[model samples]
Target: MTSVWIMLVKKSRAILGFAAISIVAASCGTNAPQDTWQPKGPNSKIIDDLQRPVFAVAGIIGLIVAVAVIYTLIKYRDRGQPIPEQTHGKPALEITLTIIPALILAVVAVFTFGAIFKLAKTDDTEMIINVTGQQWWWEYDYPTQNEFGITQPIISSGQLVMPVGTKVLLRETSRDVIHSYWIPALNGKRDAVPGRVQTLRLEADAPGIYAGQCTEFCGLSHANMRMEAVALSKADFAKWVANQQAAYVAPAKDSLAQQGEEVFLNQCVRCHQVNGLMRADGTPAIAAPDENVWSGSAPNLTHLMSRNTFAGASFDLLSKQCRDEVWNAPSDVVGTKYLAGVTEECLNQKDLRSWLRNAPAMLPMYANATQLKATGGKYRGMPYLALTEDDISKLVAYLLTLK
Candidate 1:
């Protein structure tokens, strides 16, 4: 029995040694990628700065605790001697411990309050972008575009484009439930409550595309709700604004696109709006009627092809190879070329075809019309629009011309 016990101890030590080696190997693995803490905007900078002091304080506290534990383990260890005397209390030691932690906590509170106010300040904002959150999509409206020569409000979806180095204020709110807007590399998150207007400040130091997802769990498709902020140089942003402001072009005469336009008016016009298309009142229907969407309205797809991604930035605007080719380029080259907007070459024909064929099947949403009826004709998200193959082809052809 003694020999068996000795063998078990030897086996345990061997296993412990192997585990230690594996841990060392994992820590120094050559294949491990370096962490990329990319900071694109001002809010990220503030967060990073605040985190540094907190981490420093935590490190100091951890080191002190570790040293004290090691000292106690060694000093109080048994050495085949008499047991040490039991003390009632050490008042001075207890006071030191309590006071030290209280002082540290007070310092932390001061730093926290300063950061909170700094992040929430929005007094010097140059522009205000009204951001509306819906079930699984985002709407961006330039409310004061009239001063910039735009006759009406410029609205778009999926991507938020901002001029780099500008302090832009975001007035965010939700249509239904609560939603939170977050773009990690660019800024901190802010909640969009249904009845409350929350202001968020955002500024990108340089031109780049930063990705984010909805941090609030609104519903089933909450995980799929994503967004991107495209930070462009002032000149490039101006050019984009001009392109977006351009009047919508009609489909060519005697083309299948013309028939598709008729189909769109018959079926889709109720929910969507294409500029230059006239309503029954003979006025150009540039905006979706306010009552259409459960939110304010669906996105204006007039410049749909101008943005690279769509469906709330849930799908890529370009193919994988195309995105990589653009993203892997040098920084200066990448910023100008890789804005999340559609180009003539990178359009996803297959996905777009499928989306038009059956949008609900392509992207899961609360869009089943029959199921909606079961719930007393109430649905929060987009509903399915049954369309024939011929209708889908015509729709795709028409959408292609949007570019």
Candidate 2:
């Protein structure tokens, strides 16, 4: 009997050791872009600071409890002995346990309250950007700010761009189902509720990319609803604003890209907007997503190539080499590499072509005619356009010229 008990205890410890090793290994992921511990801004730092000590306290308490339980079980083992101490009441012991926990909690509450207020402070905001969440993507609209040379509104999707070291206030709201905006490196999660506007403060300590995702389970493809924050130097951000506001340069007359533009007007203009596109009748081209999509909007692809990712940042626009060149570039040159945009030589033709071929096939979305019943003859996502091979080629060409 003693040998059997020893064997069981050894096996239990071995299993527990394996689990502990596995957990530690998993937590040490080398490419954890969404790592909460690796905070890059003051707001996130506050969260990280609070979390570390709280986690320590919890771990210590858990360890103490486990040790006490094990010690008590061993020291009071039956061992063929008679039961002892029928009475259970112990006022002094109960009181000590209660007071100790209360004191610990009181200390934690003081720091937690201070951190909440610090994170909520927004009186010193240097910029304001409106962020709207839809079914599976985030849309950012930079309101005109004379200080940044942004004379006109700039709309972008998938990627939120801001200047490094500047306090950016995001006015968040949802267009359809409830969603959440979170960039772990910059700040905490903030829900984007419909009919109500919420604000989240964000600031990046350096120029780089930070990964994020919609935390709330809004609908299908919630896991794919990802976003990225790109922090650029003030000068680079000014240049980006200028590029976004610059007049759209028409594709060369009668070229392949021009033909692509024609195809775009015939097919994509219904839902996608390409700023500065003019109709043959000299009318400004506009998109009417409200009539087509239930969400009432689609990603604005005016400067498509300027961004590295597309389709809710779920697909890469640049090839691996090109993407690495931009993402891994030094802080000073990252802006220049990003501004270069997608060129023919650097485009990730596989994903881009596949996306243009059939959007619903690549990403789960309610684009089928049958699925439209719930949305009142409207799409919850992009429907198949059924473009020919020639059409896809032309469309790709035209989209590349957006930047």
Candidate 3:
């Protein structure tokens, strides 16, 4: 029995030693760019500050308690000693321990409330953006931009764009089940619940791409719901807005792109809009998302290539080299690099073709017409359109000209 006890202790020590080594190794990489601990904005910095001391205190208390328990077990073991008195219910010791934890919690509550109030401040906010969460993507709408001298609202999805050094307010809600909006470099996660609005403040110290994902478990394609916050220079941001708001030009006559436009009218126009596509009688063509989509919305593809990513940002629109040129660029140059958009040679054809071929196969989606009867005829993703090779090639051509 004694030998068995010693063997068990040795195995326990070995397991504990391996765990400690693994934890130390994990802690070594503090320089990860997307790490929540490495705050890039004021709000995140405040959270970082608030958590550092809290974690330190927790670590110290845990270490102290563990040491005391270990010491008691080693020094007061029941090897040959007489049974101690029934001192478990000693009022003084119990009171001391309980009061200590209570006081610590009180102190923590004060600091936590202070940080919460601080992070919630939107009085100094200069701009407001509406963020809507659907099953697997985010929609960002700038309701008003008078300061930028823009009267018309701007709506975009897949990526959220902001100007550096601006405290922008994000009013968030959902169209379906609850989803969490999180961009680790900007601020903490905020839940987007249907019928209720939640607000989160986001600011970036410099121009760069900060990747984020829907932290809340949503549905079939939840893991594919990724997003990015692109912080641009003020001058470059104005340029982008101007470009996005520009008029959409029709494809030239007798061109492949023009032929693709015809294919789109017959196939893609049901759930998408080209803004000014003329019908046979020269009437304006409008996308009827309410009739076809579950969320009563679809991603507006007018300026699809202006952003680097597409399809809920799970896939890149540009080639690996060009994408790296934009995301990995220096902060000062990131804006200019991003505004370049996707060029003909830099387009990622493989993924885009595969996505067009079978969207539901690429990502799990509740898009089957028969399967979505439970949603009251609403769909959670783009259904498979069964495009022919010729149709897909033409669609790709037309989509590329969207930039």
**Candidate 2 deviant stretches above 4 angstroms:** 1-29
Would you list the C-alpha lDDT of every candidate in the order shown? 0.74, 0.89, 0.84
For model 1, how does the per-residue alpha-carbon lDDT over 1-403 read when each residue is reduced to its tens digit? 4455456556555655765566456435442221113456777787778776776677567656655655565555565778767878999999998999999899889888888898888888887889999888898988755434445677888889888888989999998778899887777789999999999898988876677888899887898888888777777777777777787788888799888877888877777777777655777765554554545467667778777676777777677777666656665665567544565467777777677666777667776545665445445565667789899888767766665
Candidate that scores best on lDDT: 2
**Cα lDDT, model 2, residue 28:** 66
- Give the residue spans of candidate 1 off by over 4 A: 1-37, 70-84, 146-151, 279-293, 326-331, 334-341, 373-376
What TM-score, computed on C-alpha atoms, does each candidate reach? Answer: 0.83, 0.95, 0.93
Q: How close is candidate 1 to the true structure, as a TM-score?
A: 0.83
lDDT of 3 by residue, 1-403 (tens): 4565556557556655765665465445655555777788999999989887887687668657655755565556568868877766889998999999899989999999999999999899988889999978898888868887556887788899998899999999999889999999899999999999989999999999998889999988889888899999889888888877777787788888888888988878888776767776788888888888888888878888897888868889999988988888999899988998888899999889999999989888888888767777777789999999888888888888887
Backbone atom clashes (below 3 Å) for every candidate = 5, 0, 2
Residues forming the 10-long window of minimal summed lDDT in candidate 2: 22-31
